[model samples]
Target: MNKQQILRNRPVGVPDEKTWELIETEIPEVGDGEMLIRNKFISMDPAMRGWINDARSYIPPVKLDDVMRAGAVGEVMESKNDKFKKGDFVFGMGGVQQYKLTDGKGFYKVDPSMAPLETYTGTIGMPGMTAYFGLLDVGELKEGDVVLVSGAAGAVGSVVGQIAKIKNCTVIGIAGGPQKCNYIKKELGFDHAIDYKNENVRRKIHEYCPDGIDVYFDNVGGDILDHALTALKKKARVVICGAISQYNSTDGMKGPSNYMSLLVNGAKMEGFVIFHFADRYSEALQALGRWVAEGKIKTEETVIEGIENFRDTFLKLFSGDKRGKLVLKV
Candidate 1:
């Protein structure tokens, strides 16, 4: 039998127990030209919040009573597809279920020997690709430029800071707690770490980047986005990655009050979905892999055991319950 978590309702705020219903069912059978996967890990992301909303977005919202959408890494249990064989490891949008049936369209094989199976869900996976393209392509980061990153202790932000350093840029990270701030500065090599929980964000950003910010990579939006706007240098680029701060708000997303700064500074702000650069993934992966192998970049994962804890584990993204990449081990 396969246990699955299904979306019961569209959440007005942070999702609670009432938002999801768990049930057990017989494992799905593999059909012609299809494969069956036994999921081992589920990737919990802030983007999942947007996926459940009925509002129009890049992708369609998950329908009611359907398995929750998620990225997962798993092993193929049965294969009727010629491309995938039994015992092969694969990654795709396998949802929050114990077993997944697919036709091998978006799915891809993964080599666990290169790194741990879970790292593919973090630094070596979507988050890593997002940091690469978002920073270099969208942010238009340059050497010696001053770069500011929010959610710096997270999977993507941590990689962003390290990549900026590798390119000879000054990197400043904004995070919630002293421990996270310290980890970014001392361990991750970020030039500066601002603890937003303890300090005035606007004042601290000014102190760190007196010359103004050349690039701002935003993860948590709301006030931080406003502050970054006020600090933009001429022709600065702002990469809108994810706005986790406003994800669960009953009120619609709050527009940055300081957006006028963009016009005043002749700056640009762009939002991107990683899939837009799907064809160029190998380009980023090669560089990311080499950096990881050389110890120039570090990856972290916060793993929670048990699929039954999916709802609580997902809430950790908003509550700051854990750091780095949040993943569920089944």
Candidate 2:
């Protein structure tokens, strides 16, 4: 029997076991042009928090009683598509399930020779793609630019900071703890890192980015976003990839208090939904894959083992317990 976690209720705050129910089910069969995959690793992301709400967004919210939405890396067990075969590893939005059936619509075959199976979901996968387009295309980063990123220790944010470093730009990362901040600055080679939990965010950003920010990659929006906005230089660009801080807001979303800086400096801030660039994903992937192969980029994944821990694992993002790309090993 295949086991899956179904959303049992909408969460008002941090989700717990009560928010989801684990159920046993029959194994799904492959249809024409479809493939059946046995999940190996499942991605747990901060964005998953937003996906639970039934409000409108880039993708539809997961319906009640349906398998909780997630991206997974798995081995193909059966295939009716010429593009996939048995034993091939693949990755996509396979949800939180022990088994997955894909119509080859949103799935991609994984090449382990290039990197590990888990790296696909971090470096060569969604988080990597989100960082790439969100930084280059949306942020319009240029050489020598100073970039500021929130949620700097996270999957997408870590990559965003690293990619900025690779492009010859100065990078400043904002995370919740000293350890994560140190990892970003020392290990990841970011120029600066601020621990929002310890230091004054606005003051640190001002001190580190003395010339003002040239580009801002926002992940955890709210006060940090307001801080970054206040430090934007003339013609600076801000990319809103995810506002994790506001995802579970009971009072609704908050805009930057320093948004006037945009008008004053002629800077621009744009919100991006990664799927909008779905057609050009391969273009971004090819370049990003090359960087990963050459060690110009690094991928970090914090995996939790078990399908039964889906609800608890997902809440890690909200609690800031996850240090990198959060994934569940099912």
Candidate 3:
């Protein structure tokens, strides 16, 4: 039997047990062009919250009674496709389930020798690609540029700061607690780390980047985005990655009141989805792999055991109970 978490209801705020139903069903059989994957690690992301919404956006929202859409790394246990063979390790949108059925579309092979499978779900996977392309391509990052990244201790934000440092740019990370702040500054080599929980974010950004912020990689939208907007340098680029703060709000998202600062500072803010750069994934994966091997980039994962704990483990993304990438070991 395959155990899966099905979306029971569209959440108004942070999702709870009532929003999901865990049930077991017969393991799906591989068809003519399909493969069966036994999921090993399931990625829990803030984006999952947006996916459950009834509203339309970049992609169609996940429908009712569907397996919760997610990314997972797993081993192919059965295969009918020529590209995939039994025992091959792969990654794809496998959902929050113990097993997945695929036709080889949107799935890629993963090598354990290159990096751990869980790392693919974190630093070398979707979150890593978001940080890489969003910072370098969208933000147009350059040497000596003062980069400010919100949610700096989380999955994508941590990588954004590290990559900036590699390019010889000054990096500032805004995290919730002192521990996370210190992890970014001391461990990840961010030039400055702001504890938004305790410090005045706008004031701290001013102190860290007095000359002004050249790139703002925003993951937490709301007050932090507003603060970063107010501190933009001339021609600064803001990358809209994710908005965890407003994802679950009963009211609609709050627009930045100080957005006029963009005009005054002659800066630009752009939003991007990683899937848009699907054709160029190899370029990012190769570069990120080299960086990790050279110890220029650091990767972290908070692994929770059991498929049964999906709902509770998912809440960690919002509560900041876990650091780095949150992954479920099934």
Candidate 4:
């Protein structure tokens, strides 16, 4: 089996091609209560950036020379666990490798007929769940409210906007380019989209969300969030899912200048990690799947072929080069 390992060093800027070292190794046997998953698709997320750093987080950092951490949708090629069978498609936190041996800590059997196996690792999976709980639960979204989302064209953001629209909110998405902005508005049914690169985000926020934003789903939490903060209604809510913009900051992330808006508007802002809701993943997945079947939400995935491209593919999230949920076809 071929696996990618994090060679001796950590990255300073973006993870480059040289950052990972690919090696061939003998496939291992499955132990009792374990199964070997032959990976098909691996998920690339902005959160992975936090996992590489040596810091205190919800999860531990990857050790040097360890298999690169990731989530994958794969088939059970071999198994000893009574819960799984041969040829069962499953999803789990199975790093960037061709095959994984799991003791069943975080693995679930996937029904291929339910949806495409790849979708399970993206829209109907973690990203979808993040959008659901982060917006409706944490943000306390209400019907007829005005909603603004940063990183609005990516995985979680895209799902956030469409779901907000379904709940009768006028949604405005903030992305980097015209194509992304247009896709969110024209294709995803968002009420409006602001290309932060070309437009004054604060001005557009005021124009599109004339009633003022009642819920702000923040994914990219730097200047875009700062701009969104200035256009809040009284008793508004901000759900912090991620801060992609500040992840690679060399000088450290600057505090939001418009935070006083929260106090002035009598609003609330809170940060949440999705893993805290692991117990309710199934609930979110079932509801999101039903929405997809009813044509209420459309999911997008930007798939990059080959596990060898992991470094370049992962960097795409920071560069604003991907259209939707970025995944690797391993």
Per-model CA lDDT versus the true structure? 0.94, 0.89, 0.94, 0.88
Q: Write the per-residue lDDT of candidate 4 for residues 1-330, one digit (tens) a residue.
A: 656555545666566666678787889977899998899999888988888877789899887788889999999998899988999999998898899998877898888897888898778999999999999899998998889999999999999998999999889899998999889989999988899999988899999887789999999888888988988899999888999999987777766899999999999999898888899999999999999989999988888998778888888989988887898998
Global local distance difference test of model 1 = 0.94
Q: Which pairs of residues collide in model 3?
A: none
TM-score of 2: 0.97
Per-candidate clashes come to 0, 0, 0, 0
In model 1, which runs have C-alpha deviations exceeding 4 angstroms?
none
User: What TM-score do all the candidates reach, one by one?
Assistant: 0.99, 0.97, 0.99, 0.97
> Which digits, one per residue and each the tens of the lDDT, describe model 3 over residues 191-232?
999999999988999998999999999999999999999888
lDDT of 1 by residue, 205-292 (tens): 9999999999999999999999989999999999999999999999889978998899999999999999999999989988998899
Candidate 3 wrong stretches, greater than 4 Å: none
Which residue ranges in model 4 land beyond 4 Å of their true spot? none
RMSD of 4: 1.1
Q: Which is superior by lDDT, 1 or 4? A: 1
Q: In model 1, what lDDT does residue 137 have?
A: 98
Model 4 scores a TM of 0.97
Q: List the residue pairs that clash in candidate 4.
A: none
lDDT of 2 by residue, 17-58 (tens): 678899999997678998899999998877888888878988
